[model samples]
Target: MANVRQASWDGSPVYELENGTFLASLIPEIGSNAYRLRDKIAGRDVLRTPERPEELRASPGHYGVPLLLPPSRIRGASFPFNGRTYRFEPNTPDGHYIHGFVRMRPWRVVDTSADGDTASVTTEFRTADFPELAPQYPHDLTIRARTELNGASFVQTFSFRNGSDEPAPFGFGLHTWFLLDGEPERWTLKLPVSDIWELNEKLLATGSRLPLGRYEALNEGMNLEGQNMDMAFRIGDRPVEAVLSKPGYAIRYSANEPVTQWVVYTKGEARDTICIEPLTWTPDAPNLDAGPELTGMRAIAPGEELIVRTTLSIERE
Candidate 1:
């Protein structure tokens, strides 16, 4: 059996969905972010959760699955779309706009349900609902998020729609912080990425792609020990999968098409958690002069919709 109910996490309101094997918790007011996913059978956490509400409030994107609108850094805090310039407040230390401000806003929970084998919660956010949003991007948009737990798998599905009178430039990604178990060296990783994006000193894509080259071992499984990376790669439209594993357990992550890029990051010696982020566009995509196919940059016409689904499945050995 499965159940979904409102719960509290360190004094913050959250919705929890639990099946027999796994439990998931999300805060509707915080980016509809799913901050915790625990493997009940294994007695371990699958996602790195914050110690308290203040920890998460101070750094929203570093703890859980925080949604990034127009995902990643944009050069100079502005970009051109449909002959109009869109601007955002510079949020990064380098005087650039990063990951958008959507992750810090509140979302409205619309529904929650539990069935025989699954529990799910749905939340929605709209640009028009927040007065301050109209000036930042100007185009009306809505994002519907659904978080579900079915037995051993946790899924997040996001539906985006351009509700403005004119076309809107779009991009989306999840900054998913995954927990590590034991020593970092005890873990290994397998990614579906084929090529690496050439990035500049500021970690922004340079509108170029390079072969995996020395990193080809990632296609198989590579040890995490002593590995330092904050890299982005290109993924195929097919439903390819990535896995992060240790001796006794593994986490399988998959995201479908329209999600063409992924960013992988892990601290070298200070490694505690890894971030396997799915991105719809490369960082600084809007500033790139390349075509959409290469840069993963595109616009959503008014009334048009984009849907993306991703899952994190726990496998116990």
Candidate 2:
């Protein structure tokens, strides 16, 4: 990615935060083109790369995570547009598409500046902004995905401008991956989760949120020794605070608006590295009227724009 003029954040070929805590690298090129994060101050890796885990570095919890969506497709084949039905190609083999408008599109650097310690990068996207989007999504809209690093945080802001004559329903959030301690089972999850949506093998919701009968909140703790989750839970999406720990290290996470939903994935195994995804809506949202959320789907009026901004960070405890 260190080329003559590909337009990257601060400075390419490396990574570090102003506070000199988080570290990101542009590697794992092919599958998931993204930067990996490491908390240098804590001497702990905030994310996993192929070098760290055999199963990581590629599409693992939005590995290189991005704005709108990442790791796959934006499959909303049929969306309502003025009482009309539209279709889209499945972005991935999973059937439905994903990641809004800029997932597969490389961002064009609009601004880059670095002082002594702090650095930032801004990217923008624009197309005919309508019908072109119509073939992909049912609505016409303009979106921007920005990735920035200050101290211990990697914030991605995704903004949208509804180019159509109505509002478009949509959801956006981090599909971040947190590396667990020894053997991927030495850590536990602590959340305020009360119910989980039942999904079929396709990872689509079955139209319901059932109170956790077996999976309980980690008010105290729960072992990952025998847990497997490719599931999303309704946690109010109120910027939930969570903690992951091992022998001598711990990770405490919290976000704005108190996220109340959680999606724990086990990567096809009964157990391994768990994907504790903090999302803005339930899966197949807007697509499936399942749980309670904005559904990443919105209704915009003529010449109206909708913007979604969220923040989350890592703390060493």
Candidate 3:
């Protein structure tokens, strides 16, 4: 096996892990994003990237697996916690604080190791380093992320520590987009979910859960032809599995507990790719008055940490 190799993607540093069957790429300069995961034998990229590397550098959310802290939107870019109001400058023009700020920021490489069977890299981001983000988030947080490739599996782990003296609300998730070998019509999906969050016109959750109804097609295997959806579903204690398959290959994604929400996006305009976001909380969770257990927000006490792990396994038919 070959050891992990360092290369440059449009002037930014990137690490590649390659074996006989797979190739995975990570970019630490961009929020430690894992921008590519390919099955060499299958000749397909399990994880999608933007058409132009420059585009991704200019807009990280347009491609790659970007991490989302306090994932998704926070209505009005403000939320009240523990009797105090915290306000974030809206990232989107629509006046909402879209994904967290870390995705576009740089992260420090902590470690990298590779052997005959596996290759891995770890990166860290300290919120205290970004003084501009302090007033909005308030709590000092250290986020450590690791990406590892072993055999046909790619694993990602995120550990967030509360470096402040007071307890703080925390939630995080991944915005992973996947591409198939063929057209969207040739793909199939299977997601384990029972209910979905009802969203208002602005695409923010309305604090209501609705049965899947016809969307239940995802429970079994459903063809992707003509299907358009952008929704978030509730997850239970068991590990959640979402499979995307074409004729000759399949990608299985699994995330463990504490990731209580799953967001799926497959709009017609972007039929070439699908996004499956495993999140710790629903959109606008902080603004919603629901309890912590229901909102999937964890109040990490001082000196405490929260961790979440997700894996993607590829198989050839």
Worst 10 residues of 2 by lDDT: 1-10
Clashing pairs in 3: none
lDDT of 3: 0.83
lDDT of each: 0.86, 0.54, 0.83
Candidate 2 segments whose C-alpha is farther than 4 A from its true place = 1-19, 26-34, 50-62, 68-76, 92-94, 98-101, 115-117, 127-132, 138-140, 237-239, 258-260, 270-272, 290-297, 300-307, 310-312
Q: At residue 310, what lDDT does model 1 achieve? A: 94
> Per-residue lDDT of 200-235 in model 3, one digit per residue for the tens?
988898888898898788888888877777888886
Top TM-score: which candidate number?
Answer: 1
TM-score of each: 0.96, 0.75, 0.95
Winning candidate number (lDDT): 1
TM-score, candidate number 2: 0.75
Give Cα distance to truth, residue 231, candidate 3, Å: 0.7
Q: Where in model 3 is the C-alpha error above 4 Å?
A: none
Please identify which of the two predictions, 2 or 3, would achieve the higher lDDT against the true structure: 3
Candidates ranked by TM-score: 1, 3, 2
Clashes of 1: 0
